[model samples]
Target: MSENSINSARRAALGKFGLGLATIAATGTGNLASAETTPTSPHPVVLDRFDHIVLTVADVERTCEFYVRAIGVKVETFGSGRKALVFGRQKFNLHQLGREIVPHAHRPTPGSVDLCIIASTTVDDVIKHLKAVNVVITEGPVQRTGAMGPIRSVYFRDPDENLIEISNYL
Candidate 1:
């Protein structure tokens, strides 16, 4: 077959295989190795295998929408009877804002509620995504020690002004 025919056949094969143009081109050029089936990580170290993280929000539906629409997290369940909103990797419980729990005087203080979510993505990406969604970030993607080890973290608040931390290891 002519070179054009060979190239066209390869292109069709790659398209059917769901490979990107870059991956197809690299394979065609023979510069990429077969061993490199997937992209390589710089560290390649395994992070924590956490099952879930939970947060308390004032409005479960609003909080659930924020996560699903903005943060790209899929909602697993909406509360039936005071249960939390369970998303892809996290769960959030909606604590009703009332006169007893959230007294008129206690509405202005810090430490009322706080939560942090750790992800595989970088700290910068998390900050950018949150900022895009108008989520006010208060702290850094700074490195810190946790139960697992060191991690990169940023702090922010939900609609209820509850402190939240989003983190991943550097």
Candidate 2:
């Protein structure tokens, strides 16, 4: 395909994901990776798994409470009441909206993240647990493509309405 048509097609695809060309232009990340190609021209960097991710929420304690009940994570208080939801190999630092720590996102908005998490338990068991805790499953026990391969996922919303997909690799 011609470059112009390729770019136009990419823009259309991104638009379907609610990502506008403006978002791409603003970030200057237009020429990112695609499933069809690997952009390995740059030097490959060796890296371990993610240490943690910061979750911006309205109320830290409330978000912590919901994650604890919904996902079985242990909530821990860190420096100066900073909260984190700790799972086996993942930790999410809870940044209470306006009171975010330094060097955070440009606009750390709550409910902006569609986070996909790998669960240790079966998706069916997770659905039952979610129902038991009064958490509404938005969608799934459906199949989806994950980073590693096929995953069975159940979707739900956090306290801040962040879409959470709990999945098990199949």
Candidate 3:
């Protein structure tokens, strides 16, 4: 089919949901009813980017060390000797298994996350670093869709089998 014909068909299909293709592209996919149901006044609760995250681990020390070696995160100690793996503005607070600090995830489990982190350097450099640290890459330095758009990524498993993806925006 002609490109114009295909595009028209796609637009018509999207129109069935009461939204045109342009609206969907600009506003993102959300409940269509939200436009009518949402309050006109600003909501009280507002949130932004993550400040830190928690990783419940079998061995906090081991996890910290592995992250330090593989990704160049700084291992830090805070109040009460609690450990955190820090990079850029975010940190991963380590919670030892069966002894997690209070106010944790309802079902916090190790190796449950498939986290994608943006790297400061190139994907090639990240691959080289992972190899030097003896971390086996499970997937790629190939093209993948990142949150912002196209990215090049490398995948590997951390000590607890958590899938770690290092990416560079393309």
Candidate 4:
């Protein structure tokens, strides 16, 4: 057979397979033949927003304290005394050094992550708060592109050396 015919056959098979998988996911049944019964415009699974993020830290207590004081989040304990920093509806869960849970980041080293946190207040106010807490600003009051759009941000670090950007949407 020619290469073009082989490619066309492969594409047809893959398209059928994808539709079958989508059906199985929607109905929680593993019947590939049932795909035809599913709606033509099946709703795709979409995530709304983040609820929490885990930060692997060298010292959980120290990291928690830094966020509480500098970023103005409150600490909460849950599920066998795990510490989390809570702000609005989101949180940062702490995983202590040498005690990381299974299925974590490939390189769960301290200071490895660079996270940009959204600030409700202006960047200037964020700067003032940082100075008041004696947290050193590494850079910015600079413009950067955020996930939602344009933002103004300032950069700093936590006790674990994780680069943090506090940003306000512009």
Off by over 4 Å in 2: 1-44
Query: 141 in model 3: Cα distance from truth in Å?
Result: 1.1
In candidate 3, stretches whose alpha carbon ends up further than 4 angstroms from where it belongs are: 1-44
Query: Please, what are the lDDT tens digits per residue for candidate 2 over residues 1-170?
Result: 86456655655554322132233223434422322243323546422245699999999889988988998899988898788999865699999889889999999999999989877689999999999999999999899865544679999999899999999867
Superior by lDDT: candidate 3 or candidate 4: 4
lDDT of 3 by residue, 1-170 (tens): 86456655654543423342133323543334432344333655423246688998999888988998999999989989999999866799888889988899999899998998877689999898889879999999788865444679999998889999999767
**Candidate 1: misplaced stretches above 4 Å?**
1-56, 78-83, 98-111
Model 1: per-residue lDDT, tens digit, 1-170?
86456655654544323233233233433223342455433445422223443344556678767766545765564435444555443455445544123323435332366766666577898888888878777888677643333568998766667777777744
Give lDDT: candidate 4, residue 149. Answer: 44
What TM-scores do the predictions have? 0.52, 0.74, 0.74, 0.73
- Alpha carbon lDDT at 128, candidate 4: 94
Candidate 1: worst 10 consecutive residues by lDDT?
Answer: 16-25
Question: How high is the CA lDDT of each candidate model?
Answer: 0.55, 0.76, 0.76, 0.78
Better TM-score candidate (1, 2)? 2
Q: Candidate order by lDDT, highest to lowest?
A: 4, 2, 3, 1
lDDT leader: 4
